[model samples]
Target: MAEIQEKADSGKGGKKRAKKMSVHLDMTPMVDLAFLLLTFFMLTTTFSKPQTMEINMPVKPDSEEDQSPLKASNAFTIILGDDDKVYYYYGLVEDKPELNTTDYSANGIRKVLISPRIKSNDKMVVLIKPMDVSRYKNVVDILDEMKITDTKKYALVDINDADKELVASKTGG
Candidate 1:
């Protein structure tokens, strides 16, 4: 009986002196997850290029009674046909402008006018009025023409108020 009690006390003391096991988490998987998320965001991010020009549009007039005027020297109205053709007219919007006959010939519309009013400094504002069935290519071509013609200042006119039939009658495809 004394041997059994001595064995029991020794076993209890040995159990009390045993070292405890500690748990540690591995950080490799967490680091890998962070790198993967960073790569995904880098691949999905979009970069933007700056615009070439700074265009300022005119504000709308207060009342129908008031006729706000646009500068004649810096204005043009471009007409596009359904068959991918272009025509241009220039002057003040308030003055009911007319296009020069020499500007357009058998070849196509001319680039830049040599008139007393139009100079290098004076920017021509272009207003495009496209036909209903006009091709997108035609519009682009007209814009390119505007760029080529030294007519940097331009805008697209809404066809809702424009004469649609006149726009449809431009020559050549």
Candidate 2:
């Protein structure tokens, strides 16, 4: 509780007593000032911007001009198939390149991409070939994995007919 007190000495040669008065402290102005400051800060405060991946889109060619081919000898290909299955090959897709199966697990595709042989190869490139039956999330997951693994030299390639036939033979589809 707020207390106001006044003391006086009414003895011989004593002065007059101090008048007792109630202290009128209007908290309304202080509360209004606090609310104004809060509102001003809330209105002027900037929110953190959302982060996004920066992808440089290729400009369409005027005509079908031939471009330089990718080096298959120093390439690692990943083919996304139905049911979230991932097939990969170390080098070029030969007449019957051995297709290894893996998942999107922490120890699955991550292990392969982070291997010493692949990681140490500065000239190695990753080719991502997503099939028609594959989900859109499959592409996003692989792209995220590439970013997570720090694989910069990568490209999104179309699944060729040979690769389709090979996948069909393996998947029995």
TM-score of each: 0.44, 0.67
RMSD of 2: 8.9
Cα-based lDDT for every prediction: 0.57, 0.86
Output the lDDT of residue 118, model 2.
90
Taking the candidates one at a time, how many backbone clashes does each contain? 3, 0
Give the per-residue Cα lDDT of candidate 2 at 151: 92
Q: Candidate 1, TM-score vs. the true structure?
A: 0.44
For candidate 2, the clash count comes to 0
Off by over 4 Å in 2: 1-48, 57-66
